[model samples]
Target: MPVESIHGRGATRNATPTRFNLQERMAEGDWLDQVEALDGVSSRRTSVTIEKPKSILTRNSSPDIGFDRSINAYRGCEHGCIYCFARPTHAYHDLSPGVDFESRLFVKPDAAKLLHSALSRPGYECAPIAMGTNTDPYQPIEETWQVTRSVIEVLLETRHPFTITTKSNRVLRELDLLVPAAKLGIASVAISVTSLDPKISRTMEPRAPSGRKRIEAIRLLNEAGVPCHVAIAPVVPQITDHELEHIVEAAVEAKAAGAFYLPVRLPHEVAPLFRAWLDEHFPDRAAKVMATIQSLRGGRDNDPNFFSRMRGQGPWADLLRTRFEKAVKRYGLRQTRFPLRRDLFTPPEGAQMRLF
Candidate 1:
């Protein structure tokens, strides 16, 4: 069965059965019948589920990543970026890393409360807590749930240092909190702009804000006294790679503090899903794109090593790095890491009382 692109969605299929044995019934007679019934229909309404976890902060020791602690307000991202490395996470819930990862969503409503409790612990250590490390913190459902906003409120009240990375312009919604946090040198933001072309953005990140909107967001954030940067994450070869210099120039024009990028990565189930997406959207050069990506990943679909995963190893990777370095230098955009202050961190009122 050929995978056909769904309208307003990035993944062409609902279940990818091979990787994790998730949704293995797709080949069943009854399942095929059901799938056939919904072949051309594209109206996939998003469904939200509330999840109450005991804790909200996640601690990781990944050597490549900058931060040690992070918060993910939502489990499945509605942005529906076909190449999202986080999509495989949905398989843990017996859901498909394909369409289900975007449509069937889970939100941690108690995130703020849990974060407060964690911060109030007797031995709690203050570090920059990262948001949007896995799934986007400002994904569409955030408008109603406001979980991410609530988490930010807790962080602000406690005077904890934090950072946010998102592809949505929706981060501006919490400017009231962000502006104050930024003034204290405790907060910063990074907006991802994968491609300047609207057509490519629509198909690649179907539900994410357009590249134009993201660029405008960087401008607005910087003007508001917030240290903002541009992330050209997962620069798809044979697709959006041509716009590298153009994106860097745009970031400079927006007064971005710095800019960075990563070559496309396809880890776990994302590889097949991305392949299907390629066949659906860019059938013309899909093969070339994969070849380039494999070259960057050392002939594998993905490079899972520590430092190498962040920066690919090969001529293609070297070329991307050289181009990015020259562009940032030529455009005068600083490549320096955004400095966040941790000295100002203060325990929440409850924690302070407990100390006394």
Candidate 2:
């Protein structure tokens, strides 16, 4: 049986259903049908329709996070990182936080324009507008949609401070804009490098670029005078922890100005998804990994408490911290945060309003 795609409805038959009611229901939008059918029973290949959202700035005040506002050009990432904390966000849109989270992606075509409008609004504050805090802004679709690039242009023109977090070298494509922004102290970038091992990276981040490429991205950004940082984030215990020092060393070699790390967070549906991935990839070591994770999570899959969530708890967590401190010192990685300037911010030039 050639299952073309995963149907959102109850069992979708690829071999033409015998039931007329099923076909009618599918046609009526009661279910989703992939537009393209592949020969193999792989993940669904559906046409991605664009949704022009009304607004783009997402404000937050979580003590665990650094930024006050963030923007995501796309909902649901193609990277398919099993440990993504953003997975639960898809559920708010009435979509499954699992397979649907990766397959059914939405692009905000109006993101750049909306961001510009938001920033230009009177009384708008000039805090760093975080990008890729949810789904990556430089994901594969960026090549076609160009929403992230346009948003960068808007930020650059207005001298707005912004920070980007991505695992793709595709960001290098926007160096022309980034270089100018960096010179003005209006921009910085952090590359998320999970594991140095390609095999582990493939399973951990599925469709994301290779770990080596991300290192190269950091180097390129630094060379262009853009402040580059390496985020050894969601550090999976027992699995990727050992590579923390190695990753930091590599980042140092690549000329990353600063470095940061976060213990793996398995909030919401991520816990089970991570477990499943572990079982599939490292069954023998699955128990040990979960045990260590639970220890960090205070005997739970996750600890939602403010500060503790960013960094974890227990002996393993302390060890990771010590390791990070040692590596940063050893590699001469800066502990100082990349502080974006607020004084440089200028409202978009236009005669649109004069209420101020």
List lDDT for all candidates, in order.
Answer: 0.87, 0.81
- For all predictions, the C-alpha RMSD in Å is 3.6, 5.8
Which candidate tops TM-score?
Answer: 1
Instruction: Pull out the clashing pairs in model 1.
Output: none
Per-residue lDDT of model 1, residues 180-208, tens digit only: 99999999999999998989988989999
Per residue, candidate 2 scores C-alpha lDDT tens digits across 236-325 of 988899899999999999999899999999887677767877887789999999999999989999999999998889998899999999
After TM-score superposition, what is the CA distance of residue 173 in candidate 2 from its true location, in Å?
0.4
Compare the candidates by lDDT and give the number of the best one.
Answer: 1
Candidate 2 TM-score to native? 0.89
Clash number by candidate, in order: 0, 0
